[model samples]
Target: MKLSYPVHDIDNRLLLPAGTELSGDVLEDLISSNHTTPSQTLPLLEHGSVRKDIVKFISQPPYQLIFPEKQDISKLLKQMEKVQFVLPFLRSLDYFKQYDFTTYNHLLNVFALSTLLAGDLIPDYEERIRESAAGPAHDFGKITVPLKILKKRTPLTRAERDILDHHTLAGYVLLSYYKKDPYSLTARVARDHHERNDGSGYPRGINLNDRMVEIVAVSDVYDALVSLRPYRPISYDKRSALEEIVGLAEQNKVSWDVVKALIAHSRTDKPHYQEVEIPSEKRGAPPPGNVYGIIAEETDADASGTSE
Candidate 1:
């Protein structure tokens, strides 16, 4: 008999003994969940410059781009198709929004933004999910980098910087065996995310091809600027982030088109998880049917009384 189990469900601090196997039923449950996520449709992009910014306005912040309900999958596929058509011009803009985003959220936004940028240039950018996943997950290896260094309010010693530099390599090894896409981007993005145009990047700046490395370069810097790094609190606003990216473009530090696309993306509602200084805020939150819709499936949080 097959046993069902959930890693998140079990929530045990320690793993079972190395050689010990789980009951068939428990193992089956975990494996099933791991393998059985409902297949989502490929996200579509009509314009390339900054899709997410518009998506925030049209779709609502709660709506997830890559993963949504099966009922919504068809819509996403259609959108992805649209993106293919207009992405050459539509940039993913991130200006400001109310949602609170953690590191993971920041990473996903950059990944999506960069993917949109690539899709504008490449027809089959969907295949770049492998690359997109790498864009954000690359820093997971920083588990050894110490939260202090990552979120530090002070300067770092050379020794601390050296120790922290191995995050990319560590991320690569961690994801190498993941059941999902191989740790393909883990090593590449993490290691090279820092490499610069003038061959000033770290981890053996091989001076990679301009085309291939541009995505990581732009995505990395954009996220860094927007994120509240250890030494800094409340990073740049979306517009400021866009300006910085453009500045890099002017220096030929990055492709002009890529910078333009990112600048466009900085217009997104949830841009970099920081709301721009404004006079007021939106009246109410979006419908629960958007992203937290999953909760409705489990707990019926969307009460019948709440009318459209």
Candidate 2:
């Protein structure tokens, strides 16, 4: 088959340009390859199903507390559907659905929460929509990490933890490459969501400045804290989760306004965003080591084992 568009790997390497003929052998190789978009679009996420899932998620607790109004939900749903048309986003979702359902579920939750929070934080409907694309693809870099590490039931060793932490950098590069835009909001969110405002977060440990990044960062942390993880023996209850987030705000690790927006949802009373007393001492991040070779250096023993 001839191609209408050029094909690139997740790293954005040009594998086959437009008008390249695909013999049967080439087609087979392409199908067997991971992280490469196929010549033709396969079945992407159905708009109806995604809309249904988003609606159901928001109807539940905590999410139900600060759900958007009817008009805003309609607008948000439309924008989400628009994201499915982006090849990289679609491919990333597809990959997660097939290989990592846990991340896929997390993706859907973050996708709904980030966009909902955006509606509250961002006044302009268009900007909210643009930022909506960031959530679904925020953890797209995890596709490079082995499933064994991601789904490990026990604690990770220092080396394994290092590799897991590299997902941020991996996602950042892959997202930027996927969109062919270095400064894309999705890529930035993937890169910076782990970042704290106090410079205590990972990868760069730089303070987060982007509002979109801030919104997703709060959503990502909240969901992770509240949801059950293999490493976490018990998921945090709603109030406890919010308290921890509020504490982070007190520590200047996250934006107060963004945190308040999240807190506002769980309450019937109007949320007031007053300055929480900042801590006298701020925590510092350690200098980053060379994680570029961590994954490549993994051994079979490490892959099959867990650590505390």
Candidate number with greatest TM-score: 2
lDDT, candidate 2, 153-211, per-residue tens: 65565667765776776666555555555567887888788899989998778999888
lDDT (tens digit, per residue) of candidate 1 on 193-261:
666676666665556454435776787777666655545555665555566666666666676666655
For each candidate, the alpha-carbon lDDT, in order, equals 0.44, 0.67
Best by lDDT: 2
Q: State the RMSD for candidate 2.
A: 9.6
The per-candidate count of clashes, in order, stands at 45, 0
RMSD of 1: 16.3
lDDT accuracy of residue 234 in candidate 2 = 64
